[model samples]
Target: MEALTLYQLNRRIAELVTNSSTQNVWVTAELSDVAVRGGHCYMELLQKDPDTGATVAKARAAIWANVFSRLRSDFYIATGQDFATGLKVMVRASVSMHPVYGMSLVINAVNPEYTMGDLLRRRKEMLARLKAEGILDMNRSLCWNEPPLRIAIVSAEGAAGYGDFMNQLNGNQLGLRFTTRLFPAIMQGERTAQSV
Candidate 1:
């Protein structure tokens, strides 16, 4: 029988992981938690069991400051979404292990299309769920207001479309008096839902 110190055991595991994996591989996982500190993006990635909804695997990952800055902008441009919690992402990363930190993935690139497709699929699934629950169109039976006089506008401040809509409504030749109120909201990115 032989005894191994904690450091010796951890070091052996680290060496095994580093040696067994490819230098850079593409992986898909859901972002369970994400944060930025000191310009670096740190994340918790996980995979859940489809049938039971239990997390089956999890890992820590990071994008260095230099890569984060560029990747963040490129991802947003490609997907029209921020790298936020709950996002399913496909990333190119290298598996690495540190004796103290255990195992982590060092992310270098992202496949925005995968996230965009996931979002679309999720939206469709949500709509289907709502329909099955018999609430998808709960307001469809509401009476329509003919010549609707009251307008409630939810839009970003200084939006050209809002201004144009107001101009057309207020400057109508019929001179129909209408009551209108503007409810400003953030129109894009992660905070859009909360703002609305």
Candidate 2:
């Protein structure tokens, strides 16, 4: 057997990934966090064991700021949900890997509807579990209709999703006034729960 050089190993892996198939896939997951640095937005997406609450799988993902900015605007216009930590999202991505990063998904597009479906599914599951435990309506319903005029919102700094949220609120015709405090949170991955 012959020893494979580092260059040879990388080339082989790249070729295998590139040649296997070309697919445009839509993936659904929870957005754990988003960060912007060096003209790119880095994201972490994850899923966990429903019963044990342990992470099952995770991926590092990214969007160039230009694409992210446009998507962020379009997403908000299409859906009222703010793209933030704890919100579910569906992304159309390309499978890719870097020598240093190992594996990542380069998000080319997003489908808010798909993400919403995932959220609804999770919501239903939680509702069912609560019903089984006879605690579905245990807590008094809290109305967030009149959110504190001074708000501490947790979101990704400079993220298009966050930007959209702010823009909508700021542009309200009623001149609704509020002071916003921004707190950063990881929007995806196992650590997302803790970050929030």
Candidate 3:
């Protein structure tokens, strides 16, 4: 028997993956924690069963730094909400596998509007369900003043929402002096939960 050369092994792997399957899919999922590491941003995209409130499926995805930076800015400008935790997103991605990382999705682009719409729909559904269960008004029955003075905010370091939140909190109009402590989190994918 003859041993395969490194180049031959790599070529075979590439061919196998490329020809195994090809699909252009639109997936709607909740964006949890997002983290950028080593020039790559990793995140988890998940969806839950509407009636049961149980997760249906989840996947690991990544955006290379170049793509992430542009997409991040575009998403924020298009939608008031930052592309961070608690945001819903619709992604056009390719299914890929890494030699070491196993299965992953390489996100090509995003539809912020679609994501926002999905989020709103999900929120409405959740609210309706809670209302029917007699728990929707539980928190609304209580009221409290906004915090004064120091604010400890936890968010991604350069996330657009974080910046906006800080700006509003420190703007001169408020005339309220305060210090901000930002505890950065992974913000998007599977690591997001772990960081929190």
Candidate 4:
């Protein structure tokens, strides 16, 4: 048996990866982590087992500054969202291996439609589940008493919408008095769910 140093083995792997047919392949993966540094986007891509919800495959990936600058804005324009953790993305990438960094994918392009489609699918699934549980129409089924004099507003303070709502309610032509309370809440971004 012959022995090889760690660098020699890594070099061989790098060569194999570079020459492989996987170059310029399209892959669908979930972004477990995303970051931008020095204008380059770095990400960790993964796949999970549908039934168990456990990660089954994972890889490191990156988009160089030149490509990332355009792709980032394009993706945001198409998807109405930024590249963030937990987003499923379809990307065109080349598999690369380095002696020090092991393996990573060099992404050159991204398909924003893939993420949008996935979001729609997930929303549909959630709605279906709520329907099955008989909660989907719960709000519609509720009966209002006396046209609801008390308004509980959930919105961020100083928001334009909040001001508009208050103005509309206060300027009502009927001159009816109503009690209103503002419950400040975050309306968008990552912490919105928890904050709201």
Q: Which candidate number has the best lDDT? A: 4
In lDDT terms, how accurate is model 4?
A: 0.86
Candidate lDDT (C-alpha), each: 0.86, 0.75, 0.75, 0.86
lDDT of 1 at 174: 95
User: Per-residue lDDT of 33-61 in model 1, one digit per residue for the tens?
Assistant: 68799999999888988899688999999
- Tens digits of per-residue lDDT for model 4 on 40-138? 999898898889968899899999999999998899789876777677889999998888889999999999999999989988999999999999999
| Models sorted by TM-score, best on top | 4, 1, 3, 2
TM-score of each: 0.67, 0.61, 0.62, 0.68
Angstrom error of the Cα, residue 160, model 4: value is 16
Write the residue-wise lDDT of candidate 2 on 1-196 in tens digits: 9899876787677667754353458888777666678867787888877799777988888887878888877887776554565567888887786665566788879998886676689779989999999888765565666656787888767666788789988998888898999999765445667878
Q: For candidate 3, lDDT tens digit of each residue in 40-73?
A: 7788877877699577888888888989888878
Which residue pairs in candidate 2 have backbone atoms (N, alpha carbon, C) closer than 3 angstroms, thus clashing? Answer: 31-187, 31-188, 32-186, 32-187, 32-188, 33-186, 33-187, 33-188
What is the lDDT, from 0 to 100, of the residue 138 in candidate 2?
A: 68
Instruction: Indicate the TM-score of model 4.
Output: 0.68
Off by over 4 Å in 4: 134-196
Task: Spell out the clash pairs found in candidate 1.
Answer: none
Candidate 3 off by > 4 Å? 1-17, 20-24, 122-162, 174-196
Instruction: lDDT winner between 3 and 4, please give it.
Output: 4
Q: Is candidate 1 or candidate 4 better by TM-score?
A: 4
